[model samples]
Target: MDETKIAQLRNQSIPPARHFIDGAQVSASDGGTMPVTSPIDGAELTTLARGTHKDADRAIAAARGAFDDGRWSGLAPAARKKILLAWASLIEAHALELAVLGVRDNGTEIGMAFKAEPLSAAGTIRFYAEACDKIFGEIAPTSPGALGLVHKQPVGVVGAIVPWNFPLMIGAWKLAPALAAGCTMVMKPAETASLSLLRLAELGHEAGLPAGVFNVITGEGPVVGAALAQSHDVDALVFTGSGATGRKLMEAAARSNLKRVYLELGGKSPNIVFADAPDLNEAAKVSAAGIFRNSGQVCIAGSRLLVERSIYDSFLEKFAAQAKAMRVGDPLDPATHAGAINSESQLARNLAFVDAARAAGRRVVTGGTRILEQTGGTYMAPTIVADVTQDDPIVQNEVFGPVATVQPFDTEAEAIALANGTTLGLAAGVWTRDLSRAHRMVARLRAGVVHVNTYGGADITVPMGGMKQSGNGHDKSLHAFEKYLDLKTAWIKL
Candidate 1:
């Protein structure tokens, strides 16, 4: 990366004007703003509009107006489809900028963010754009001349609260389907990383979305996020965060107007590597990637590695070696395998988890300490823990860090039992070449999504959600439309 190339990349990444409301960029009512800091080096990246309750009110009112006015809701399916496709095109045009912002704001590796986030976001937008036209009403057989039909209608104003991890992409996952259903929205981006979402709102306006159809409010969760969840004007609430926060949002929604709530919450997913795995070496590499990718901040990260007792020694040897070899450095560096933790608090929490695992008699196989000399940023070395029991605190809790605890299981039944022991049922992986074992594991697993031989592989075409405390309601594919639309049975008398 020469000076010219670096300059070109930096020029390509432009932070958007902070607040987007009613198709305009404006500051908070109180003229208050917060500095958006890059997690890479703790540098102040940009100042974003710090939304207050007044701003939240304005955004909600705008969303309500958009839904009631029917500028978007009343548009023909084809017209709406065209506009959404245009929005997707704008996302594609600024994909690199979004990815760069993601890395700068959230400390995600630029290369991974570039390849994964933008493509996923654009694919989501395109998926919903195509789905807009496909949403149809169906006629049912009726007696004589009587008419009976089922029609799916937009649910009106929607409040979308997205997490910092994969900010723009997950925001798109929430925004696209809701917009395609002709619902107006108020988006609440996470306080830590909101740059790309603000940028998305700008592109959405340029793509010809109606005023008030899309609005954004940026503030802390207790203030802005709670208001969105509890707003009477918001007909539905969609959230991605911790299970505790999701529960609070649910309560808020109930207290306000019993608004529909969809939540995608926490996970303590298990990645099982069996003795009969074809390639223990490859399994170790894939498992390392599964947990350490994104600094293991992912909600569906396979944080718990359950190995068969017969292969635990060999597996730990290879896994520890791979973990030790990961390059933790600046997210801007394309060669960097892992980046810094998102924030100081997150780093502290990860460190505490490591301590707890050690206290519980688990052996630290590899990296565990904070790399302060690496940069001023929050960086946790990739860690591997062995001899962890199923009852260990680290194994059961959602550490949300670049840490993996390897626990040996005696039999397939024990592995299944231990994997499903946690309250979360978000995602799990089974690494084995045996087709019968794969089928059996998939059938027996309690998670909503189970990976057979690999992990962390999902697409816009697939429906994603958790079975239990991880939260409900599908996120991707046509099934996600159910959360934004209501089905009505209409009967007409001849």
Candidate 2:
């Protein structure tokens, strides 16, 4: 990490961004543009083509045509694998540029953004690239000298809606596997974080992805996202965003061609700490990082802290100290532990949660106020609210900020109940050295991923999905390929 180079990149001018549709940079049909403001400071970095339903239709038509003609879909699996690997390599080659661009766009700390965005995207692409060629169709068991074949075919065209917090990373989570499986795609990057992914689309084209094989449409979610969801030509839709938007996509699918929908909606995940645990200090540190990292913009962030009553006071002390110690400032600065909030609106929302907690007489354990406003960027102190019940709105809802709520539970059953009390069950953390209790908690927790001693850092080898309102269908791992593939059975008479 060269600080000088990062600083230079941070100051460099960005080119005008446009939608990458049909292998070319294009403007919206209506010639509209949206100003892209960098949350690193209150500065307009660039302008992007403001897409609409017509633009989406054009992109989808291109994808439909490409899929139908087999320009990409007709290629051999190894050929597709080669191109995808090339794309991944291109991403790695431009990792720093993309990371800086993303941080400037979304205000994630550069230290975290480098790995979380571009490098993570590259790794994801490579993971699916390696797996695509190895999957085999099955030969079904049959009677009387008859052979039955089961084929795995690519679902035609895929539509993806990715969020702002980790645009490139989450975009690749949908893009890589679908491309690996030979599905053409049209994507709508979140309005706030479109630059990196638009650049990613260009790299994909440079790596020899055919026109319409992978397209990006940039604009507001309601117009562009809704178009992608409702397009009858789109065979499946995958999204990583809020639950409200997820429901709209589902409704659009139902009204149109009934495209398969896979959603990774945000969660209010809980992190539990017990008395007889491993190092409480380390648990407290990891738990704080789990939520506070990326400014708690992660979909599966540990926003709820459930501490055992026996060690409640002590654990709260450690946690609040950790929160207060985090340096929240310019994202480009390497010394900063946490970066700016993604936008002014999000900062306001986070503070509202804190103010409500205070109004209700909850103890503001550490931080609850906006900070570094003199710098003209959106930043907030990492907040912890103690003495709150599960019924508190701050505890129940996904604040999607650096705000965390702490509650105490006396018994193991009570801890499990409180952890599972939220409707959103995306991820959870259980810190305990007791092997039997760890196993029991893992079994009992309703989340998609449960960490026994760790809070975050689950790798791509495992599936990440949600249960209940958190939405369905897994991302990462081999299971992700299933969403892009369709199984067909062949019956023959002998």
Highest-scoring model, TM-score = 2
**TM-score, every prediction:** 0.97, 0.99
The TM-score obtained by model 2 is 0.99
* Candidate 2 global CA lDDT score: 0.92
Winning model by lDDT: 2
Instruction: Write out the backbone clash pairs for model 2.
Output: none
User: Whole-model lDDT, candidate 1?
Assistant: 0.87
Would you list the clashing residue pairs of candidate 1? none
Count backbone clashes in candidate 2.
0
lDDT of 2 by residue, 1-494 (tens): 98999989999999889899999999999999999998877899999999989999999999999999999889999999999999999999999999999999999999999999999999999999999899899988899778799999999999999999999888888999999999999999988899999999999999999999999999999999999988989999999999999999999999999999999888999999999878999988999999898888888888999999989999999998898888889999988888989999999999999999999999998889988888888999899999998899999999999999999999999999999998999999999989999999999999999988988887788898999899999999999999999999988878
lDDT of 1 at 73: 96
Per-residue lDDT tens digits for candidate 1, residues 263-333, read 99979999999988878898889889999988998988999999999988988999988898889888877
Backbone clashes for every candidate come to: 0, 0
